[model samples]
Target: MGESTAPILRVNQLNKQFGTGCRQCNEVGSRQLDKNYCTACGTVHACQQISFDLYPGEVLGIVGESGSGKSTLMRCLYFDQEVTNGEAFLTPYKDGSSNLFEESSQQQRYIRNHLMGKVYQNPVMGLRMDFSSIGNIAEKMIAAGNRHVAAMESRGSELLEKVHIPLHRMKEAPKNFSGGMQQRVQIAKAMSNNPPILLLDEVTTGLDLSVQANVLDLIKHLQRELNISIVLVSHDLGVIRMLADRTMVMLDGQIVEQGLTDQILEDPQHAYTQQLVHSML
Candidate 1:
């Protein structure tokens, strides 16, 4: 759980806006609209002035309702979206000297391949539906320069087994699997490279309660076994409580509060956080 130490990843003044900065946008920004959408210039501030540190083996949970920019933050960090402003430093990348946002495309590709793993809320976004479960896991391993077919198969099989996916189903395509199974395949693929950090965006969002419990338990087990830092984003406090060592509460495009998971859940200080905690009661 990292306890107390320097962070493995650091983000400073991160911002992501989907529009040009114009006088109209300035006026709208000055008005401080509660929603991210701007009525004047039609810009969307998906993330604004976000900053955080994620220590090794620590699970940092980001919780917010739909359109709250939690997913956007994950996308930006994973290089799925470009950052409008700010710097991100990953300890293993370039010795944490250069901001990851400023890296070359090739460097970013290498970083994503070897250093970080991501599992999106939608399996469609994370898995290649046409690819077999083993093939999907192999794709990430190949990206990290794995070449031996036998070794890849062994590693892939091990990961799938860890996630409770049947060995007989390893050659089956994810499209043929159930939603929970597809998500498990995604998790197995994300862990293929044994990355130091993992980003999970609502990984249990649409599952049945029983299925969700299984997936969540798998995640907790994997975290302990892998000792990887994780940034978990979910609207469900229960999920956060089950997985996160620390939690951050977000609203609109900004973080309203952050602290130890228990502190944030049990003694919510912000009004929105209080409302969220109350609803869970």
Candidate 2:
């Protein structure tokens, strides 16, 4: 990722909050709250004024503990949840001139199908458990307007092979596979449409150590081979250290620190970041 290269994805002041705000918590400068929660209004600010750029072929890691809003940020980007207020621009969409949040629902669906692919932390969220593994990949391709059965079948087989899923078992449902295999199937399905941007939300979480290593290796290899931009969200710094070029540390629904992954690991600045680094040590 060259610094001179333009960002494939740019987000500005992205905010996602639940519940209506009261006068006490509505004020911009004077709003006081417990962490990300507004005490007076009973509102939870899941993401607050989040902004970042994802360059082509770059893996940007968002690291935070649970409830720190890292996953929420990913959800907003993938259009799984609507943003309260913000603007996101994609270079492949309208030359980055239009804010994706303002686009109609139909247009947003187009963006989701063609421009972005997301693998959720849970395989169930990303896959149809009852559908065959290859069928899941075909579902995504079909959503992207692929109607040719032979082409979809060929593409699905290639993707399954890319993720190291056995070709013989391509007809099996995800529910019949182990956790690691199911996640791999999800990866294949997500990549089926050849999306430019991939969102991975704790993709390796809840797996055995060996399984986690295998999944991480698959993602690393696939990202390099495809040269796709990735926004990887995880609480594990070890995972970020292994995969991310740059890191953004979020705390209380805000970015506390951000810099090159090596720099942040060596000399963390923010108090929360320092604690995180120290914990890893």
- For each candidate, the alpha-carbon lDDT, in order, equals 0.92, 0.95
TM-score, candidate 1, is 0.96
TM-score of each: 0.96, 0.99
Task: Show the lowest summed lDDT stretch of 10 residues, model 2.
Answer: 22-31
Question: What digit string (tens of lDDT, one per residue) describes model 2 on residues 1-281?
Answer: 55689999999999999988888776657878799999888998889889999999999999999999999999999999999999999999999999999999999999999999999999999999999999999999999999999999999999999999999999999999999999999999999989999999999999999999999999999999999999999999999999999999999899999999999999999999999999999
The Cα error of candidate 1 at residue 45, in Å, is: 0.9
lDDT of 2 at 241: 99
Candidate 1 Cα misplacement greater than 4 A, ranges: 1-4, 24-31
Tens digit of lDDT per residue, candidate 1, span 71-108? 99999999999999899999988788889999998899
Clash list (residue pairs), candidate 1 = none
Per-residue error (Å), model 2, residue 10: 0.4
Backbone clash tally for model 1?
A: 0
